[model samples]
Target: MTQESQAAEANASGNDNLLLQAAAPLLNAVVQLRQAVTHDDPAGLRQSLIDEIRQFEQRCKQAGLPFEMIIGARYCLCSALDEAAAQTPWGTRGVWSGNGMLVTFHNESWGGEKFFQLLSRISQSPNQHLWLLEVVHYCLLLGYEGRYRGSDSGRVQCDAIRKRLAKLIEETRQPQSESARPLVEVHPLVSSISRPMIPLWACATVAALLACLLYSALNWRLGNDAEPLLRAIYQTPLPQITVGRRPSSPQALLDLRQRLNDVIAAGQLEVSDGAFGSKVIIPADKLFAEQGTAINPVGRALLARVATAMKNVKGTVLVSVFTDNRPVDNSRFASSYEFSFARARAVTQLLQSQLADGHAIRSEGRGDSDPLLPNDSNENRTRNRRVEITLFAAPETLSNHQGTQ
Candidate 1:
């Protein structure tokens, strides 16, 4: 083998060894997970597994291993429980909370401090963050009660984080094109091994004979089968495609638009009614607490006026917050997406009450993504940090009534 091929093989072997080492601590946990999936855990097993995980994490950190490998493995187990429940022969699967004591995959606090630590390591490798995302998703899925739990707003935030982690994994998982490495010439003796060649004309004649026989056989069989096949085809029903409804024109919402105009004029807000949809944009600094997620008094008053004006609007209320591409170090918010989500939820909660009958409040946190302007200058970044509220109707509906997978 060439030196280049040898080096490549060695590198691959090293990576496999490291992954195996990281997964070593979870041997006992996997056994426990099997029992948990069957709902057959023995007494005291829960606390014992939790302690093992906690110690394993501490050791991983102290030893400076990829900090998130353990987290990812535990999450993989939890996800396994969900899959089992889904595939159960017994009726509809309710919530799958069989993750045992690994609710957040840690005995540690599921508060801001721990989350901040996780967020601080966003600069770490994708392998690291995949593990962190596993933990974050645990907080959302495992019936853990917190500010961002069991709420539409929290789900939206978790979804944003999930999307980010997915993208990271996808980017890193791509097969890298190896650069051409210089190779040494092989010996003539090694290269001389060869197979005898067949005559092309003889091979072609054999192939043609076989093809003719196969074609005759097919023709005979098809002659017998053709009538039945054609009959079945003619009797088969055509599929019906469902045409979707489009959004009504903005002219229908002119009265509501005019009412929202006064609120737009009073605050640092922008309004646009276009072919896509009608949206109200409020600057984040004007609508939220400085470097915080809570809506300030001014923002509250402004949103309150908006809610009052749109009380009669009949549709799902869409609230989305976009933050600038800036790293955050606050005690409350660990990342810009979390910050955006919290504010979006705050706005969503305030506006929910005024929603018309059957109207639901949905919020999203698009952090430093899909920016309104490039973050080249401070002014541009500021322009990108904004909140959008849409009086959603049929067109703005991302999915149908049951939601698309």
Candidate 2:
């Protein structure tokens, strides 16, 4: 066979296997349900029905089928069967739905006949035929209404069963043996009949005894001293607090900033000075266009710090990076400063991709307009060719700050 034909056959075989596996549980449920009903125990039948439904649901999941549909089908079937069982011989000829069952006993156009005609065909002895009929009724209900009405139908069937049970109880009478029992039996006498009630407070004695017992129980369960000694053995220590001092001076800020910068620098990211601040720039052509060049250690480290800073920063901030500017590079930027902006944008994209909430970050690139220095000397030009980041107050912050100002 051709390769494509072989692959198709393999896929079909796999599907068949899955179906076979799923069928086992469903079959087991059906068997259990049958056994429960055969025993004539309503409680057992109900439990078995629940188990069967649960098994069917599990099978659906295993077969990668929609579990809800299976459940719906079961519900519809059960409801229909219940409705059929509850109806009198005359009431059996009807269609059932969420609203109610419709009975059509005699209608010339619709082959007018009492619905009891169907139930009358089944033999009353052994109850198996009735049980089988119930199952068939459920199946018919499922076929007519589909899975959508299963849940409602199932609930209705359960309610009908409960009603039937109540009616059964009302119709039942106690057996002769049970009803003929004596009202009370006399105990063997101990011979002495002495009554001693000298105190007038004897009536209140019972109330006092009950109050004492109640108080003791309350103290045992809720009183602090009555707490179990085992609990004290597993007690944990109180948590410790470590307060951090805030950086005040520009030097302190610079020191902390340097420490953070060192982590990014260690990663070996491309760095440059910009109009506002020193920045880490990612080479877009190397990182994006050509995926071969992996993000260097420096880029990863910088990304990490940027992610950390993002969490604490109350206002919206933009991170921009720059790459080497080429005159022939008609993408966007012409100068090094413009290239720096692109680099910053690349870094911003990287950060956003890494962080789950990165969509909240606002990012942009300014080609070469804002430069660190005059692009005259090579050294100055290199310094100018850099990414820039600025913190802009969030709208809420801006409004609050403006109000305060």
Error of 1 at 289 (Å): 3.0
Candidate 2 stretches greater than 4 Å from native: 1-261, 264-297, 322-342, 355-359, 393-405
Find the candidate with the highest lDDT and give its number: 1
| lDDT score at residue 357, model 1, on the 0-100 scale | 60
Give the per-residue lDDT digits (tens) of candidate 2, residues 202-253. 7579669998988667433332221121122112222232322222232221
lDDT tens per residue, model 1, 19-83: 33343444424433433434433324445655665565555544454423444444343333333
lDDT, residue 281, model 1: 85
lDDT of each: 0.52, 0.37
Q: What lDDT is reached at residue 393 by model 1? A: 53
Candidate 1: minimum summed lDDT over ten consecutive residues — where?
105-114
The candidate that wins on TM-score is 1
CA RMSD for every model? 25.5, 32.8
